[model samples]
Target: MLPEKTDTVVVGGGQAGLAMSEHLGNCGIPHVVLERARVAERWRSERWDSLVANGPAWHDRFPSMAFADTAPDAFATKHSVASYFEDFARQIDAPVHCGTEVRKVRRVEGGTGFRVETSKGTIEAQNIVAATGPFQKPVIPPVLPELAGLTQMHSSAYRNPDQLAPGAVLVVGAGSSGTQIASELQRAGRRVYLSVGPHDRPPRSYRGRDFCWWLGVLGKWESKTPPVGKAHVTIAVSGANGGETVDFRRLAAAGITLVGRTQGYDNGVLRFNADLVANIAAGDANYLSLLQEADDYALREGLDLPAESAAHVIPSDPGCLTDPILSLDLAEAGITTVIWATGFAQDFSWLQVDTFGPDGKPQHDCGVATAPGVYFIGLPWLSMRGSAFIWGVWVDARHVAQHIAARHSQATG
Candidate 1:
């Protein structure tokens, strides 16, 4: 049931694609949204059962609709988030062809427009917006050897502790997902070991405000990319326990064993980098630096905010840092499961467009690609640091839609 032609074709059905469709409709541009599965398929299927929005409901939503009957500061469950996107798509009347996968997108012959092949049918469009979100492919580092009988899966594939083997669990990457999974397993009476990595330790709430609110009010959301040679670190904050800070010390105190970054797998043993203490210190530094910034901002603005406690600024050393474990035998430790909460990577192999950079990411000025009529949306930091999240996707969608509208106008006029 695919259309033979359209003014544009959006290549996703998530927040970014739906937002793009809404804007395209606003500008009287005819387009259809192509989704491989139901709307918000990843949110509906890929996330863990207990997963909740990392940001509160009010901040992590599109401008068109608010999460119904949900508190502004409350984190919506994964199911609720998927329903929200489904409801948004319905309200916007987006022409989304769910269960229709886009197999390939390439420039049509004669150097004009593009031809898109899909699971349903073929469609030709004047412009195509690659609104595929950031978490397209799970990235599990090859730090561990292929051990027989070990239950290994990415965070996306993880559901609950009961699904894991009845043994100790090793969760790699101490980002929000890793920490949350480790905590869940430990609470379920399974010994858990969490692999620490370079991550930002932002408090869930700082100075009587959510960290997200601080990012917005302090103009941090409008921050640009980091300078050359600076890698963006993952923020280690959680929305679980009704939105609380992810303190490694507290996690260790709760009986989750902390380990350094996974180095590699050797003869019947796992190796770790001897950087556990350094990692903890770096995370503490990040936390304290954010606190200082918030305090300075409040002071300059003459705003009466709650003062953070000394204990909150200074972190206590955990026992694992003092006595780091550089190697472990999985069999000896009774560890039978390994959940990789590392992260995701972008896959653009089907996008046969010369718009990608040396890093294999789409090269665009804002959302407009270097190749004519080829646009990209929803990738992390596509235009700004905030572009990685929900609200930011909407903003980027609008910008890309405007560009497409202008181009369409020029072509028709």
Candidate 2:
């Protein structure tokens, strides 16, 4: 039997939701977490079989649970990450209601609460926390129209090179997914062409320490710098294999052909921008800027950070800097598969409130939605750049939980 109302209701059962529920429980506030599928469904099914957390297991730990028996620097596979969340929820005794899909969330007309309609039942609560992670919907551009014979799949659906058609594969977007997938395919003996895009290619490590460690040391992860209210920068660094940097130079050295950003398809020919070199240069410059910031911070703190080896920096190779292939005839290139590693967009269609900005993203000051009592957790830059990652979500989660608890107390008193 479901309750008619509750003090607070968390809208998802993932790490963010569970984290918020933990805090709510600590405050002696009642709450329930609703999930459309089993906990961490995206980790279980959406990612590739061999995919692991972009950061190390140690950094991926949440406030609810420390990663026990796991190597701190080792990458946690998708299954392991999902299992960790499941275990965390269980150990914390989070009130999670799995298989309960939220169909709609509307303000209780003229009231100080919300009505969350679900597939199972309606949940009335004084507060609602939308803990849906940042990547809500995979963005396959409108220009990615289906070709008659060639196969197409988004990176979210890609498993491995074995699942692809046995021929050349064209990976669009040079972010982490694009670079990583292209590397995997090329190594699997498939000719892979990677399309370079506007991306930041920070090295996986710098100064003999993991780049993330430096960021944490410099207080970048927990920096209270407010978001500029613009689209957040796309960060695409990787920490695979105990922190090996994956960039254009590394991919080219591994036998992957690089191309410019994909423009569109016209008359069965794919078009690309003639800016591959410029894009790569820009990415390298951004990496250098971040490295300089880290160096400055270390200097101010009197830390003796090791200097980076120029030879190990993986600079752009002449062979990889060929003239851009402006237009590619797919058949002539022998490309049989195209994987769009583009990105994702938030989907708040189920949210019946009107506090969203022009970008369709909810406007929140640190996790509290503009519509009072409606909060969001695990959103990109919710508190800082790190807020989107598992290692950083607890910052926003705790704040939201306490905000709700305070509101509940005021109502009761």
TM-scores, one per candidate: 0.97, 0.94
* Steric clash pairs (candidate 2): none
lDDT of 2 by residue, 34-127 (tens): 9889888888888887787888777888855777656888888888889998889888898888899999999898777889899998989988
How accurate locally, in lDDT, is each candidate? Answer: 0.88, 0.81
Candidate 1, which segments miss by more than 4 Å at Cα? 227-230
List model 1 lDDT by residue over 346-368, tens digit each: 88787898998888878889889
lDDT of 1 at 57: 94
Q: After superposition, how far is residue 329 of candidate 2 from its true place, in Å?
A: 0.6
TM-score of model 1 (CA atoms): 0.97
RMSD of 2: 2.0
| Model 2 per-residue lDDT at 275 | 86
Alpha-carbon error at 98 in model 1, in Å?
0.2
In angstroms, how far off is 408's CA in candidate 1?
A: 0.2
Candidate 1 local accuracy as lDDT? 0.88
Q: Which stretches of candidate 2 lie over 4 Å from their true place?
A: 223-232, 311-316
Shift in Å, residue 326, candidate 1: 0.8
C-alpha root-mean-square deviation, each candidate: 1.3, 2.0
